[model samples]
Target: MIEQSLQGRRAFILQNTTLEPPPHTPELALHVASEITPIWKMTEEALEEIGLPPPFWAFAWAGGQALARYTLDNPQIVTGHGVVDFASGSGIVAIAAKKAGAARVLAADIDPFCEAATELNAQANGVEVDFTAENLLDAPPPAWASVILAGDICYEKPLAERVMAWLGQARAAGATVLIGDPGRSYFPRQGLTKLAEYQVPTTRELEDMEVKKTAVWKLP
Candidate 1:
């Protein structure tokens, strides 16, 4: 029954959105909403009807774009390693990791809709990425993950704190941890080493500015 419901939701999302390449990462395509307001309203209505969270899986956020661009350019960072993309959203970073030749890629998110979106986007890019709806933050980092990727995850204060702690643990366990951020209020100002930065093009409907100076950081 849950599988059927997810399929129905995936169909609804594909019908309402376009499959296009993001501005910064042109090599990969995803099912993306053209306008933020209409999709946001539809997502809100869907949440009211089904008790789901907002549909963040419908857009390629600035931080994700910057991370994806960096991953594609610096393929050696993920090559031949097992990668886990946390808060996977549209699966942009996961796709990039797979394209970069990661031994395996898992896209993890709490939202069931994100699992469906990740699968669809992975197929579109001709790469295989496993999807998990589990909230992996509730437990220790998986032993199989040799590298962990997080993109645009520091929006809320509490969630950001929790994720940063978990990511720190992962780093201590010897897994390379990387984060893509647009300097949200919740992002920790300390303990991160910057790797790359990009002026990611974004829509004003979702962000205050048209271009976000996003950066990818390594957690130590």
Candidate 2:
């Protein structure tokens, strides 16, 4: 995949977004696009022209917020363990894992912009998180990941099915797999145990309502 340089992407993010604490998790600050309309309203052709995908990294999604909250509250789940945050987006969950005393944290995403965003967000939160633009879904889940966390990943049907199967493999390989979902259309509820529930505040532009009832589920 053709990718922009980290410096260029970082500049673009700083110019477009403001460092603000997400509504649900105020303890951590993220570089979020304050004016959501301009980014969200951009046409597909325009995005292609700009060589960018949907700016999922520009928002603190509800699923991510819920997962971060759950991690911070239940530190034992991550403390001293190597954790991986798949489809890391703004790296909120990864930062939360580090803050909760994780031994190491990796933020994996295919979005080229996510490497820069995750790096900046980790710095903003005073946490160190390694990031990879490599699409982790293309291969087997890392066996070293003692815990795997994913949020807001089940958006499209095909991708949801693929990710679920990959995560299931990770579970069978002895990794603790946790998913944070805000009722996405393709998210599978079966074969998962509810760990926590949260009412997360989000923008109406992203969801049907201003507040989303989100939940954290653990793979059994």
Candidate 3:
């Protein structure tokens, strides 16, 4: 069964990674791979053997770290509102929103492994975040979510375009949409109102530099 496979994958992730605090957001801790290459290789092998996607949930990305820090510092943004963290890898931002006093927080990702990782990470941080493993690309933002948070979602062109359009729709529908991006190639140059920026420390294995100038933006 799918649930059984997800449990096995979760065990594998826990076995391979260590629970530690992310560099930029030390207030939160997650189970993350210590070295990037080893996990990258292991995930590749997993892909060949069991059709697993890349293990992006095993690390705290720059955009997510920046967003989490911003949310914690600016609790008024999410407090008393229902939030949805789109592509919620490791559930870092979702946990931050919950800690910031959001009425409800939902972490949604298409990858089942990410759901497992999110659940574990939320528990580690002493936060309650619901998880949904749904591919919501074609769907409109849920009416219950007053805020939709997306992080590091502009890596690819097609996905970037689709997410931007969907977030635009969400914005028009009276939901406040926020995006955290590290200036990826496909990040939109327009239609965003910059809110905050952070020099997020990151691993060179994942990015070209040791620190990424990341920013949080509001969808227009």
Candidate 4:
């Protein structure tokens, strides 16, 4: 029997989808779905000029194509590592890490909808992940061997600052931190090392970013 989250809630691993609507239960679908196109429409020039999008709505934001590509290519990086998918939207990165053979995986996000989405998605992918709706700045799980953040902390200033601070603490505690982003305004450019780059789909020329430029960075 395939395990699933409790009724009334579950995470979903969106396939061929650049994003997932928030709350995972469809009740909040209006908010989540509404943000998808607008977020995609965000251009590098726009981000550079506007700084960050106002956090007006809640959505289970998967980093989309870039993150998906990274997981597909570097499955080995997560093999045997205890992993945490910070800001896990639709649980894509967590699912990818699980596919990569991470010994354990946890999908953490502040949005309740994201928690449901992560759990459902992980189950759909035949992967088991611990899902939680909690703020990272408050208190992070103690046992995460590695932290994998994809495309979230770079979108807003306060969120980026908080996640970065948490990341620094996690790094100091000897946890490996990896970040995948497609050039958001708040991505820290100072201490991170580039691991790889991929062409992920974007809403630009392709039907759904058949390919867009994205990069992976690691904090040592």
Output the lDDT of residue 169, model 2.
Answer: 90
- Can you rank all candidates by lDDT, best first? 2, 1, 3, 4
- lDDT (10s digit) by residue, model 3, range 1-220: 2224767778877888999999989999999997777886776666455545556799999999999999999999999999999999889999999999999999999876788798889889998899999887868889999999999998889989999998888899999998999999999968689999999999987899999999999987
lDDT top scorer: 2
- Give the higher-TM-score candidate: 1 or 2: 1
**Cα lDDT of model 2 by residue, 19-126, tens digit:** 999998999999998656685444223335654556788899999999999999999999999999999999999999999999999999997778889999999989
Q: Give the TM-scores of the predictions, in the order they appear.
A: 0.94, 0.94, 0.94, 0.69
lDDT of 4 by residue, 1-220 (tens): 2123434332122321334422212211212333444544342232344544332122333354345456657677778888887777656677777776788887776654466556655655667788767675788545556655555567788878888888888888878777877677888878789987765544432223434456778887
Model 4: how far is 5 from its true place, Å? 11
Candidate 3 wrongly placed segments (more than 4 Å): 1-4, 44-53
How many residue pairs collide in each prediction? 0, 0, 0, 13
Q: Which residues of candidate 2, in runs, are more than 4 Å off?
A: 1-3, 40-52
Question: Which one wins by TM-score: 2 or 4?
Answer: 2
CA-lDDT, candidates in order: 0.89, 0.90, 0.88, 0.59
Best by TM-score: 1
Error of 2 at 27 (Å): 0.3
The whole-model C-alpha lDDT of candidate 2 against the native structure comes to 0.90
Clash count for candidate 1 is: 0
RMSD of candidate 3 to the truth, in angstroms, is 2.1
